[model samples]
Target chain A: DVKVTQSSRYLVKRTGEKVFLECVQDMDHENMFWYRQDPGLGLRLIYFSYDVKMKEKGDIPEGYSVSREKKERFSLILESASTNQTSMYLCASSLGSNTGELFFGEGSRLTVL
Target chain B: AQTVTQSQPEMSVQEAETVTLSCTYDTSESNYYLFWYKQPPSRQMILVIRQEAYKQQNATENRFSVNFQKAAKSFSLKISDSQLGDTAMYFCAFGPSYQKVTFGTGTKLQVIP
Candidate 1:
């Protein structure tokens, strides 16, 4: 089975602090995605990388950015953490574009106070 | 742009019974993919089932099946013999390709023991 691991399952940060949520996948998938899930709004894409060092902005990438230094690891960075940034962040990876199914991590719940 | 919609915000089912969750999507393309993902209390998102647009036959995995209506643009998930472990937040997603996936608002399901 494929395994996707997030560095932290829960995190707390103060306002104006920078936050990092890390995800690593063992399947060596070529595509990785970051999303924030909020009640009533569902899961909105933040950023996605088709390959190492490649990234694309999704519907709601305003307050977030991503880094993919290696093919197996994808990291989401919040320049300045705000209360509004508190939500569940999910990471997923797939073998290729549209052909393979996604394998997701347990998710990171970040709380900004 | 493609969008997925799950009108049902919450649902309940008694153990050993059957329940269906509704999902609808809008897309301009003729070929794409649809998926049903379940997130349990542990927050790990699991792929419950999937269906391809090119295939007319509905996809089924064990007791989980999908009712895919191309003309109506509807994709509903049916769970038979509901168990306590079946309780989770179910999300419907759509994507033209694997680059990005757009998810619905999600439906919270509670399986009664």
Candidate 2:
């Protein structure tokens, strides 16, 4: 079974603090994504990486950034955490093929106070 | 820009019955893919089923099947013999080849005994 592992299951951070949410996939996929899930709003993409050291901003990339230093790992960063940035963060990886299906990690729920 | 819409915010079904969750999307691309993803209470989002735009036959997986209407731009998920495990948030998603997947505001389904 392919596995996408998120470093934290739940996190609490203070306002203006720098935060990091880490994700690693064992499937050796080329496409990795970070999304924030909120009630009623659904899951909005923050950023995605198609290759090592390559990243692209998604629709809701205003308050977030991403890093893809290596092939198997992708990281999401909040430069200055705010209460509104608190949400369930999901990590996913895909093979980057025509019929690629995203394999997701167990989300990390962050609460910014 | 492609947009996915799930009209029903919530639905309930009795155990061993069937329930269908509706989804609509707007896109100009002819080659694309549609998917149904389940996010359980554990917060692990998994792909339930997927269908390619070029395929006329609907996709199915065990108790889950899809009603794909190309002309109407609709893709609905039908869950048969619903079980307690089926209670979760179901998200409808559209993905164009080599593009970010767009997700709908998920529908929360609860299975009653």
Candidate 3:
């Protein structure tokens, strides 16, 4: 079966600590995305990469950055984690074109103290 | 950029009943797709159903179906004979025939016995 694997399911860090959320997909898809999910705001895109070594900012890209060094791996980075940055992060990948049925990972829930 | 809107924040329905969740989107693309994604409590997100803009027939998957009004730019999800397992947060999404997709604020649906 196809899968998107997130390296961590839960993480707790200090306010100023750097955090990394890793996502690897086995589908060899061209498009990978990072989204932050919140209670009332739903899922807001943080960043997405259409190809390796390429990335684009989404609506809520503030305080976050992403890396796509390889086709199967996309990593989300929180340079300095803040309390407000604590939320469920989801990773998704899709084959580009009209059919963008995203395969998602079991999200990583981060809590900053 | 395309934008999606889900008017309902929370909704409930009795078991064996039917419920409809509304979604609207603004897009200039002639060819695109609409999707209904369900995220169960403490679980991964999954695609429930999708509809292509070029198809006139509504897409159905067992108890789930969509009311796709291309002219109105409205895509609604209708769940028939709702069960307790159907409780989840439903998100409405719009994607172009390319590599981008936009998600709405989502509706939390509760199925009560």
Candidate 4:
């Protein structure tokens, strides 16, 4: 079975601190994505990488950034954590196609104090 | 811009009964894909069913089936003989020409015994 593993299931960070959320996929998919989910707003895309070094900004990319040094790993970084930035973060990977279904990891719930 | 809508914020059904979760989307692109994803308490986004816009027939898998109205841009999920495991947050999503998939606000389903 294809699995996407996250580095942390729950995290707590202080304001102004830097945060890193890691995601790794067992499948050799070419696309990886990071999204933040909130109540009533659904899931909004933050960043996505099509290749090892290529990245694209999604609709909600202001407070987050992404890094993809390897094909199987994608990382979401919060430059300066704030209370408003705390939410459930999800990582997903899929084949590089519009119709390909995405495989997601168990989300990481972050709380910024 | 593509937008997915889930009018019902929450729905409840008795166990072994059938339930339908409503979903509608607005998009101008003719070639696209629609999906219903289930997110349980574990917070893992699981693909429940998928429907291709070009296909006229609805898609089904086991106890889950979709009512896909391409011209109306409505895709609803019907769960027959629902089980306890069927309780979860159902999200309707749309993927247009771009690879990014946008999800609806989600509907929380509760299965009562």
TM-score for each candidate, following the candidate numbering: 0.97, 0.98, 0.95, 0.98
lDDT of 4 at B32: 89
The digit string of per-residue lDDT tens for model 3 on A1-113 reads 88999999999999999999999999989999999999888888899999999999988999999999999999999999999999999999998653889888999999999
Question: Cα deviation of A108 in candidate 4 (Å)?
Answer: 0.7
**Tens-digit lDDT track of model 1 for A29-106:** 999999898999999999999999999999999989999999999999999999999999999999874564788998
* Top lDDT prediction, candidate number: 2
Which scores higher on lDDT, 2 or 4?
A: 2
Off by over 4 Å in 1: A97-100
Give the residue spans of candidate 2 off by over 4 A.
none
Candidate 4, A1-113: lDDT as tens digits: 99999999999999999999999998999999998999999999999999998999999999888999999999999999999998999999999864759899999999999
Q: Write the per-residue lDDT of candidate 2 for residues A1-113, one digit (tens) a residue.
A: 89999999999999999999999999989999999999999999999999999999999999888899999999999999999998999999999775858899999999999
- In model 4, state the lDDT of residue A47: 96
**Model 1: number of backbone collisions:** 1
Q: Chain B TM-score of all predictions, in order?
A: 0.98, 0.98, 0.98, 0.97
Docking band of candidate 4: medium
Q: Please give the lDDT score for candidate 1.
A: 0.93
- Summing lDDT over every window of 10 consecutive residues in candidate 3 chain A, give the lowest-scoring window: A95-104
TM-score of chain A of 1: 0.96
The local distance difference test score of each candidate is 0.93, 0.95, 0.94, 0.93
RMSD of 2: 0.9
Docking quality (DockQ) for each candidate: 0.74, 0.70, 0.70, 0.67
In model 3, what lDDT does residue A36 have? 93
lDDT: worst 10-residue window of model 2 chain A: A94-103
- Candidate 3: give the clashing pairs: none
